[model samples]
Target: MNAHHPPGQTAPQDRPARLTVGVVGAGRVGPVLAASLALAGHRPVAVSAVSDASLRRAAEILPGVPVVPPAEVLARAELVLLTVPDDVLPGLVAGLAETGAVRPGRILVHTSGRHGAAVLDPATRAGALPLALHPAMTFTGTSVDVQRLAGCSFGVTAPEELRLAAEALVIEMGGEPEWIDESARPLYHAALAIGANHLVTLVAQAMELLGTAGVAHPARMLGPLLGAALDNALRSGDAALTGPVARGDAGTVAAHVAQLRAHAPQAVAGYLAMARTTADRALASGLLKPGLAEDLLGVLSDTANAASATDPADASEGPEATDDGADGGDL
Candidate 1:
C-alpha cells in the first residue's frame, strides 16, 4: 500500500513522489528517457554506458549521474530502466537476477516494443515489479526526444495490480499510456516497424531515384508533395490513393517497370510488389473497377515475366511472377 494514500483511497492526481532512478543501458533511448524522468522530478542516480557514443549521450542528457555497471545501477535504484536491445533484454534480466542485483519491491521496466511485461519474468521472479513501457516515438539520444515525449503514446503492459503505477509513471514522463495485451505485442511492434522503418527505406529509394533523374534538390521537390500525400492517406485511407496504379493506367505502370528493370534493377521488384498490392487494395476499397484492375494486373504480370526472362538472375532474387502473357501491351 502506498504510504501517502489510505488502503481504500485512490492514488493522488499529481506527480508521484520522487524516487531514485537508474538506467541499465545508455543507448539512444535510455539517456533520453532518464532525462525525461528527471524532468518529471525523479532523481537519476546511476547509469551504465559502454560505448563512447553512449557515454557522450549520457553526459549530454544525464549530466551528473554516475556511470556504473549494470549490477551497481540495479542495486542502488528504486526504479530501474532497462533500455537495451530486445534480443539482449531477457538474458540481461536473468543475469541480474542470478547475481541478486534486483531487490524485492524494486520497479523494473523495459523499453521493448516487441515484448510486454512477460519478458521481465526473471525480475518478477526476484520479487521486483515488472512493467513494459515502450514509448511509441523514435529516439535520438538528444533533448529533442524528451520534448517529443510530450504527445507520444507508450505501449504499457503490466499486471492488473500494477497498472495504475505503470500509467502514473508514463503520465509523469508526458506520455499517454496505451495498454497492450502481451499476446499482441509482436503484431503491434510489426505495425510500427512497417510504418516508420519501412517508410524511411521507401523515402531513401525515392530520393535516390530522383537523383538519378537529375533532380539537384530532391527533398525540396518532394517535401510538399510527399507531405500532402501522407496527410491524405491518413485522413482517407485507400480512398486518397492517386497514382498510375490507383488510376488503372496500365501503360504508365508498364513503362515504369521497364525503366526500373533497365536502370534500377534492384528497385524493380519493390515497385512491382507495391504496384500489385496497391491494385488489390484499390479494387477492394472500390477505388478501382475490377475490369481496370485486371488490365493493370495483366500489364504488371507481362512486365515481370519480361524482366525475368531478360535476366534470370533478377527473377531468382524477388517474389516469383506468375506467367500471364508476353510484354507487348499498349493497354
Candidate 2:
C-alpha cells in the first residue's frame, strides 16, 4: 500500500550522501554490476536474482548485502537497476510505482537493449528519474563479464537531465557511452542482433559445412581465418571479397551445390541462402558476370529446395564430388 500525503505535497527527496544502489535480477549483468560497484567504492544496498541459489551467490560476492524482494530494494536505495529480462521490466516498474516503492527524486534504470527509459515511465511518473543503459557486449553469466566490460561500448537512453548520470555510470564501469534517442531503441537493438547473433549463425553454418567433408574441429580450423577475414571486411568493404563467387566460377559453384546436396543436405538451405546473397553481392561488386551470377544463384536455390524436400539422414549422404577436400573460401 502506498503512503498517503496531503494534496500538493510530494514524496521526500532526501537521498543519502553516498549513492546506494539496489540491483534486481542478479544474473550475468546484475552480479557483475554488484561486484564492480562494490569494488569501485559504491554502496550496493540490496540485490535480488530470483532463485535462492542466485541470491546466495550474489550475497556471497557482495558480502553483507541483503537478498531481498524488488520493492524492498526500491524502498532502500537512491539508485535502482531493474536488470531483469526485457519482458518483465515494465510490469516490475508499474508494480513498484503503484505500490509507492519508487519514491520521488530517485533514479531507476534498466539494461535491456530492446527497450528505452520510457518503459520505466510508471516509476518516472511517480517522480523517479528513468534511464536505460545497455552494454553493447555479450555475457555468459560469469565473473568474466566484469573483465569484458572494460573498453566495451554501451547504448544509453535517458532524458537530457539524466543522460550525463547514466553515461557517467557506464564510464565508471569501464565502458564507452553512446547516447541514443528513446524512439530509436528498436533499431539500435536490431543493429546489435544483426552483428552479434547473425555472426554466430554464419560461423556455425561454415563449420557444419566443413564437418560434412570430415574436417574434425572445424570451428578451431576456421577461427583465426574467419577472424582475419572479418577484420579485412571491416577494413575494406566489397573489395575484401575473394571466393568462387567473386571469381564468377559458376561451374565450381554448381558443383559445390551438388556436393552439399549429396553430403550435407541438412545445411543446404542455409548454405544456398548465403551463397545466393553472396552471388548478389559479387554481381553488384562487378566480380561476376550477370548471366553467370544468375545461373549460380539458381543452382544454389535449387539445391536448397531439393535438400529441404529430403530427410536429415538423406542430407548426410556422401558428396557428388569424390574429392572431399576444403576450398577455404575467403569469407
Give model 2's TM-score versus the native structure.
0.81
lDDT of 1 at 104: 97
lDDT of 1 by residue, 181-280 (tens): 9999889888888878778878999999999989999999889999999999899989999989999999999889878877788898789888999999
List clash counts for every candidate, in order: 0, 0
lDDT of 2 at 257: 77
How does each model score on lDDT? Answer: 0.84, 0.75
lDDT of candidate 2 over 38-88, digit per residue (tens): 545568888776666566657666678888898888888888877776766
lDDT, candidate 2, equals: 0.75
Task: Single out the weakest 10-residue window by summed lDDT for candidate 2.
Answer: 322-331
As a TM-score, model 1 comes out at 0.88
| Residue pairs with clashing backbones, model 2 | none
- RMSD (CA, Å), each prediction: 9.5, 11.3
The best candidate by TM-score is: 1
